[model samples]
Target: MHDSSHHSVDPVLAVLRQYFGFEAFRGFQREVIDHLLAGQDAIALMPTGAGKSLCYQIPALLLPGMVVVISPLIALMQDQVAALWQNGIRAAFLNSTQSSQESAKVMQLARQGAIDLLYLAPERLLMEHSLTFLSQIPIVLFAIDEAHCVSQWGHDFRPEYLGLSVLSERFPTVPRLAVTATATALTRDDIIKYLKLQQAKLFIASFDRPNIHYTVVAKNDPKQQLKRFLDAEHLHDAGIVYCLSRKRVEEIAEWLVQNGRRALPYHAGLDKETRQRNQSQFLQEEGVIIVATIAFGMGIDKPDVRFVAHLDLPKSLEGYCQEIGRAGRDGLPANAFLTYGYEDVIKLRRLLINSQLTENLARSARQQLDTMLAYCETTNCRRQMLLRHFNEAYSHACGNCDNCRAPVSTWDGSIAAQKALSCVYRTGQRFGVEHLIDVLLGKKTERIIALEHMQLSTFGIGSDLDARQWRSVFRQLIAADLLVIEPVYGGLRLTERCRPVLRGEQAIRFRQDAKAPIAVKKDVQAKRGTLSVHHHSKELWQTLKKLRQDIARQQGVPAYCIFHDATLQELIDKRPITEQDLSKIYGIGSRKLKEYGADLLRIMKQFAPDGIDV
Candidate 1:
């Protein structure tokens, strides 16, 4: 709960309430800001929607000199700077997209102490000219965004991040703050070590996002499945559909549009202009879907994404978590659906094996894949499994996942596991899932005959089940650590864990895949019971959004930069009549209240003449 106090009374709380329109700091925001204000280095491991940006944004306002933020993505910097400008903060970004004059003007402002926060990419900051210019400025502090990129163990590792240590070398006295939304224990250690934040205070917020309901299903007719999920669960809502390849992204985008949905394609393969335009549309327009490869959503700040769907398996759980974390950023109910098949596993394994990664890095990547597969196959609780990967423990089940909603049927899979292990061992463990399944199904194919695997003692011994069932059994074996894929040759091999199951000393239970839901329900609603104006105030909400969209277009900013859906929800709830009444609503900062107060009040009066109190 917020403190419910006006900002003109207290300085720190005033900055929060006046600009950001929040009455209080969430999680470790105040602690981290206090540490930074005391001239101490810190590291914050907050979840995506946990207000990581505010931890630094608020401090920059209180600190004396300009705060230099090392951001990774250009789009991220643009979004952050724009949001800051909307808050009436003096923020600027120096990026490759800016013209020479624009860049010089921004730096001149920073040099003149006119900018409170300045964002620069790591690559640009490490340049000789930029460093020379930065050396001349009075930098109060340095912030490293997406600090996990400094570690090889991180999913989005970038070599340029290694040069960020120069900040500590060049400006040894200035406090440094490193922030990341997703970092494992190893990644955290790597970030501290690599960024040289030896004495930094570590702040880790709870990784749980209770509003996001996770659902992982077996991929059967993936395109149709995604369409059904979208049509049934999230009609006319903004969401992101992630595909593994650019072709798939374009195909999905086109398919969605053909099916009477508004969608756009975004990926690295698209022309830069097209990609930027599509991304802008996704950010600016309401209920526009963006079908993209993983490259599209590094630092997207859109808060009303109602869903994030994955048509293929991610390479690791970290990537999966980071991607799914994009939804429900507004603390509203959202959905994350992932559809995976055995083919996804095999394809990912082959890609990892054929990559140019060093041995250690490759091994770490394979381990991550194994963890992701375990997560996809787990039937206990999806949120629990996800949190446990980050060393967070949960004793009870989260009722929001598919498992808790509809329990899966489990069977004593020891005998089936033994048959799978025997097939791997007897076939010399050199074949992939296709040939292994063929052998298990007693199919007399040319490859099977060529390998002469037919004469093996375990051959055709377990023909009771079909190939699909065998595939499921083998997938569970891999998930359970009884079998592993040999990275070098991309073949299945038995692990030490297989010995117990094969010896009948251990019993294993495996979940059969849940039947896909024919049609999921649309479940996203703001404020639950408090939002009783669903039918009555529907027109009012649409009118408010249209007004916001028109103003955003005039200002050339994203619609959310004008007002968030949560803020609009407040307007619908309060039915404010006068300027003072509008100013009291949540997210209506003083600056916004003064600038658009009359217009908003008029809209409210038009909608709720009888309900207006003033």
Candidate 2:
């Protein structure tokens, strides 16, 4: 076994090796499992790729009875159960997708004590029949997946989750494990309170996904920008492109397909069958891109997604983190690129203000929007800014994000900010950035000429910079919280926060993106070394991937289910010769070793004859 702990192979490590085919547990996995195995409740705040499921799944294997997982969506449940089933674990799910006959079969299996793990949607679990049925079974534990949904303040709150507190009321003795990939302290507290987890041990993993290079660009010709990024960096990789609306998802997916890229659209607006087909296609096929809305990627378990690009602004920092977390699951390098424009911000503002959200919720939503906007406009390390939002402290620059890689240059923009603020104020703050910029630059546009704005003292004052530079300045000012776009008028308005800078009481600096078009070099992962495959291992790696793909097709499962690209990379790097060596590979659990060990060994010897154990 791979030595996870320094001690000899203990029971947990033995289970890990026999089942998951690994030597050791990662980070807090062992700690969380130990706590749960000791019959204590726990909450794990792990990142997307940090193996949160294993924390509960491993414990479930060791426990006496079946583990019940409260998952959010049917697709997510199916993927997780399929992966477990591939690992030779008897896992099943109950969802709307199942007929009454199928559901009854699964329930009968549960009653007979046959299933190791059972996944259910929250609504299904809370049903009177469902709860009564569970009372008859030997339930070892309850694992609440995506526990953040229980928080009303969270990005993806579900009303169905609020009823989960009854689990404590009904099964007071059963251990409960609540897990989420993204949750702030507030959301975390809400989850603990709502779920009624009694003195639950808290395990918070680092929110950093170091392998994903974060980049935010100004939204210029959005579809073209998306196309260029995909073509340049992820032409042959699997990825997701997130849009704010169903229409945009369909249009972008169609555009990608028309351009010879195999892309599919996913949204709540699609028929159930179509959505399931698109999601399955995305997960089961390699190099397939899914153009989707926010509704698509909450609990997807695919591990080799190469990138996630956003065509518009996300409503909250939590939402942004959760969406981008979908990439780089197997620890191979991935990329997250976000494109935001002035209209995106305005649209979000309108959504928050005009929606039926309560007063406090609206305020919180606005605050979240400001934080996300600041993230988009930051001149420092994107990773640092992102971690700080989650209350995780990173003392130095990450050196992995686009800002740290390119090192943005800055110039004194106090005068420019004051001039911009004055232009907005003198122009009555009722006009948007275009009219304001035209007036500032003394343009002879129809609106400017018709409004007679050329007569103001601030008119023609911003001649030192071009219109594009002024636009950047305005964008930065808004990001800095010095200005806000009114929801009703969609016009520029100065906030009280802008007073100090406008009055020359404080100095402001702006990033000069003229050096690079706000878009960094597309080869972010190659530079990071995580995605940089060695030349000697390249051929073998490709061969392993081909074999895994073929096996996946044969099994009717996603290629990552057979083996993730990261796992394949390790196979090439290690060049394992014997069954024992194969058993030491991270993702090669005992079941997989027995199933494909001979084929893998044959392939290894065929490609790397000199390294074989003859």
Candidate 3:
């Protein structure tokens, strides 16, 4: 048995307890921190909101000298630095957003040993001068946030990240930590290889986020459907609306704003200030809606976003999960609203086929999309299907999603699934979903006759089911493992496991496809009203948030990056009077107390003298 007492209290844990006020680590934080503190390189695959930042943040504080965090997006870096400052940690970031004098001041602080953490964009770090300057600092730890971007095959790839291996080579003695929320097995291997962290410890956290409800609506009159989704049940909830194109983002943002919703547009085409301003407003204000393209939402740290609605199908499951993971970071219930249609799949496939990546990468991307499509189309428990994709076992059906809460009537689809599988085998497994659908529905058009699929015995076997029913059967068959899609061959194929069912030796079951859930209308008056202010000490929370934001802005960072909602809630619950009392609150550290300890105390003094002041 392991000796629990021998596990010495990590210096970082002390900082965590002193500054953040948390008594223990969450998820893989303890093990990951231990590995890094031991001076080892490591790669962490954690789901969003799993405290991946803490794995590095704690080490940065505990280890003597500075930690250089290489990140891709300037917005993300700003947010992270702001969050560090809120905990009273001295943190600075060098990115494109800063002027020359500002950059010089930050660098000077690093050289003078005044800063504990410094955030750098990968592109900025690639500069010769920056690297030379970085070498001078007593670098304790090097962290690569969003490490998956190093992989060319990843959904979000940055060529600059490829050269980050030099950091390990130049500072061979310094520990390195790389973290990302999404990575397939392939992406994981690529990150390890590209970053040259072969000997690094690996931590893979459970991918399940049970608080987010998953639902997919069939794409028919999507605009009307979206309107129904935004109605009163979700009113007053901050959410993101993802669009496929810049034009759609603008149009949707305009529509929502015109309808009196606090909405804004965000896309690559928008000016940097506008995008930054919109994102900041959304983060600070309640019930703000951000309509954006895929270009938005990387490294965003919003915790209370109530839902993430997709106006268009995402390119891959990795992208989808990362996007939706932004919601409910505070562990409250959230929704993932997806609208799917045949055209979306076709467009996604065409985009994948057109990409310059190798056939293998393209195939893998396509397979991921297919899996997402299966989840969207599945009539099974939404949570179970999502969990199963990540190799997790989830037995009970989640009753919160659209399907389970309002279940659709399902008929026995054993015969339909059998016919769909039969078509794949009879066609030599060379046909895709469309062709197979034709064969089952007895549609002997030119292409059908040209392929001589008319000769298949299963051609008319599924004639009883209409085109929609047959399509549903094919979808269900793939989900049940009775059928598999061959991405390389660009078609569907029957698996060996399908034999028993074909021969009637085994039974096949399927949930008849449920009709799309009806959209509920929102009460306009309710949506336009302000968030109900309920506070035992309303003035105290406001004062806390104001001081937090002022300090964050001066530090050139995002507000929440300083302190999470939970930590702020704690301040309201028990106002800390002394540094010791503050240390007892979750997420407070000595470094943070040294920085913001006085400010917190002053705020409490302004309210109640006998009340504890930080």
Candidate 4:
């Protein structure tokens, strides 16, 4: 119900106020929108929760013809289109997930000029029929979401994304926008080449999600540690638990369900119907925790996810950031919790060696893994170290991370480092961490006895440190680049970086491992509400949620599609009575006011006598 004929000094802000109910553009949104509105191509490198969509969406509304958005997943397309419809914007998608009749109707709409924004998966959009159909339409611009997938160096590289370059070739006159959340120097260059955005104006937003309290703990009784994290903060909240394998996903999902949590498993291995059902449950319901592999992340549009925990390490820091970035998308305080150990490293390295990825890709993956390990072992400010990996600088320590919250103590570990390096060297530089640990602890197992006389001079020299402590030293050595995992045999080998330590020319310092379970953010939920709402009355909050849920269920969309929890919270705080006042609330746009404002205001009026304030 936006007034397209209304002319104002700043047309974009007028549209934003009419549609989004927000007073200002976040970060580089207005700049990207300005570039596209000026008939120039652009690239936006923004973080996950950043308003990257608005950068193109606003321009689409003001442009002459419909803008085609190239999205990655079918789930993402459906979620976005549903949300768009709620805001009174005309949007649709075509993919394999839809029936031919449904697709034909959307095509009919496009041909009839009844659609504003149309989304397509890369593979579908690049099809000959799809290209031919677009050629006849009055097309305007192209927006490529998740552009990092176009780069081979990116964590989730998709061959289909390479086909997107044809968009520039086929629609030569149309401007384009390539948007992504995480990309390294190599991936950024690759996106430019693949998307032909070399001449586009680039907008790089800061990658920091300051609201996320980062915490990484060494794996010790992982199940208990996870439970404590849940109980301490997100006991009944919706969150994601990422596992490295499908089996672990299933196991964790089952365990959580058995232990009185609403949990579900999602992975490629699950049958199509099961996967869809689990995903639907996660999106449509609240307080439902999803335990899944990396496969579950790309299309998650849920705004109120309270936490992202890693039971095992991710392949790279890029992947880690993207996954954890799923949390706190609503701009409320959230958490990124991880529990890892040396065993996790060994398993992942071995898997990498056995996988059939190309040699070039394998080398890149190894480097990414090494960087990720080093990050986990870092005792400095987590945010500063993480941002540095992205080639960005943070001038000061971020007090939100675990390292900054609880300053870890450092101690001299030169002797321990020397002993671990010597054991790797003395054992022919071929044995794995377990074997090395056995030798260091002077355990004469059958394999050790057969391979050695138990008489190597370095064999029992490391008995002063316990096995766990010795494992920590080895893990840290790997993190320090002093040791490398032999790809073929999954053994430890010395790197040149270890030479100084071996020769007693350099001293090593290590952070004493924090023995306690994860440190909980005591006032995190209190600062943000228990339900991530700002209201004090739990009863009124639940009532508003129930109303939103009812409307969303009737509309056959996620509850957030009706109005985000943030908007509901504002309704509580503002206690708007009239349509004009309702229009002033965040997320309550003109179209939403026409559609749901009556119901919302009616609900608020009933509770007005209670004098509630969010």
- lDDT score, candidate 1: 0.86
TM-score of each: 0.92, 0.95, 0.78, 0.94
Name the candidate that leads on TM-score. 2
Model 3 misplaced stretches (Cα beyond 4 Å): 1-10, 393-409, 414-510, 516-563, 567-614
How high is the lDDT of residue 94 in model 1? 96
lDDT of 3 by residue, 1-614 (tens): 88898778757667777656679888879999888888888999988888788887877778789988888888767666666666677889998888999999999999899998888989888889998998898999999999999887667898889999898788898889999987787789989998998999888888888777777876667777777777734766789999988998999889887877899999999998998899888876657999999888888888878889997888777789999999878665677898876556656666766678787877788777778777776667887877677677888987766677667666766566677777788888887887877887788789988988788798877778787766666766665667765645458778888888888777765655555555432342223212223464777877887887787677665556566556676777776766677777766666666777788877766766454332
Clashing pairs in 2: 2-23, 4-24, 21-589
In terms of lDDT, the poorest run of 10 residues in model 2 is 513-522
Q: Please provide, for model 1 over 1-614, each residue's C-alpha lDDT reduced to its tens digit, 9 standing for 90 to 100.
A: 87757534767788998887787888889999989999999999998888898888888898788998999988778878887888889999999999999999998998899999999999999999999999999888898998999988876889999999998898899999999988898899999898999899999989999988888888889988898888766877899999988889989999999999999999888898899899999998889999988887877899999899999999988998899889978887788999988678777888887889999989888888888988888888989999998889987999878888777789888888888899899888887887888887788899989988888877787688777788788778877888877755668989887898889999999888655753443343333222234787889988999999999999888998888888898899878787767767877888788778888988887887564465
- Superposition TM-score, candidate 4 onto the true structure: 0.94
Q: lDDT by residue for model 4 over 1-614, one digit each (tens)?
A: 88876554688898998888887889979988888888889988999888889988898789878999998888768889999988888999999989899999999999999999999999999889999999999888899999999887876789999988898899898999999998788889999998888899888889999889898988888888898888888878899999999999999989898889999999989998998888888988999999999988885789989899999988899999999999989887888999998778888888887888899989888888888898899999999989998889998999888888888888899998998899899889898888888888899999889987388877778889898888788889988999988866779999988988989999999978877754455565476445545445566788899998999889899998888878877887788988989989988888888988888888888778565642
lDDT of 2 by residue, 420-504 (tens): 9999999998889888888888887888778788789988999999988988988898888888888887898889999899779
Q: Cα-based RMSD of the predictions, in order?
A: 3.5, 2.8, 6.5, 3.4
Candidate 2 global TM-score = 0.95
lDDT of 2 at 149: 95
Candidate 4, residue 365: Cα displacement in angstroms equals 1.5
| Residue runs of model 1 more than 4 Å from their true location after superposition | 1-8, 424-466, 486-491, 518-533, 609-614
